[model samples]
Target: MQINVNLNGTEQSHDVEPRLLLVHYIRDVAGETGTHWGCDTSNCGACVVWLDDVPVKSCTVLAVMADKHRVTTIEGLAVGGVLDPVQQGFMECHGLQCGFCTPGMMMTARWLLDHNPNPSELEIREALSGQLCRCTGYHNIVKSVQWAAAHPATVGAST
Candidate 1:
């Protein structure tokens, strides 16, 4: 199938198998490797991406299902070569240890923040419950979200 996708503010078209996962299409065809595949199942939330501003597990979504939709990965969060608020939060708070689940976590957090700019700590924890990190870095990850909420300027306040 030929899929037309708007990714990271750019339009792209690619011919791929209907069964190809959106994660694979983003990584292989779109050349966006920032989105990782930690677990094939949607439960992991490691392959999360924003489809038209809503977070979805890319590994479980078919590439054809994303046709004509805007897909935003971790790479898309940056603006003017600057890290997004979530990205800056992760970096400043040391939210990542192994960095494997950072992208997915960031995408999900971004979505949450978009809806609720001032999420409480409990809300942050609830938002991140779906994503698992073996390194047990949840402490800093939650702190990062809190920091992002407090310092929205660094994240550009556009989100």
Candidate 2:
């Protein structure tokens, strides 16, 4: 299958297997390894990416299904060498420990802030329920999202 997609603001086309998972296409073909591949069963949000501006588990999506759509990975979160607020928040709040789930956590957090700039701690927890992080116990992760919320200017500019 030949799929064309707007990846991280760049138009890219690739020939891939119909059954190829979007995560593989992004990592292998697109050369964007920032979207981590974890738990192929989709239980882990490590493969989360923005498909047409909405967060979806790349592991669960077929590469062909992403044809003609826009996909944004962690690499796209920053612009002009400046980090997005969510990324900065993660750093400032020490959101990640093992770093395995950081990419997905940030992706989901970015989406949550895009839709709801002022999410409560409970709301932030609920939004990230699908993503599991064995490290940090989610305390700093919640604070990370809250940090991004408080700095709307940075996040809004990145988007």
Structural similarity to truth (TM-score) of each candidate: 0.96, 0.96
lDDT of each: 0.89, 0.89
Task: Give the poorly placed runs of model 1, Cα more than 4 Å off.
Answer: 155-159
Q: Which residue pairs show collisions in model 2? A: none
Tens-place lDDT per residue, model 2, 23-64, is 999999989899999999989899999999899999999999
Q: When superposed on Cα atoms, how far off is each prediction in RMSD?
A: 1.3, 1.3
Task: State in Å the error of residue 38, model 1.
Answer: 1.3
Q: Please, what are the lDDT tens digits per residue for candidate 1 over residues 10-110?
A: 99999999999999999999999999987898888889998888889999999999999999998888888888888888989999999999999999898
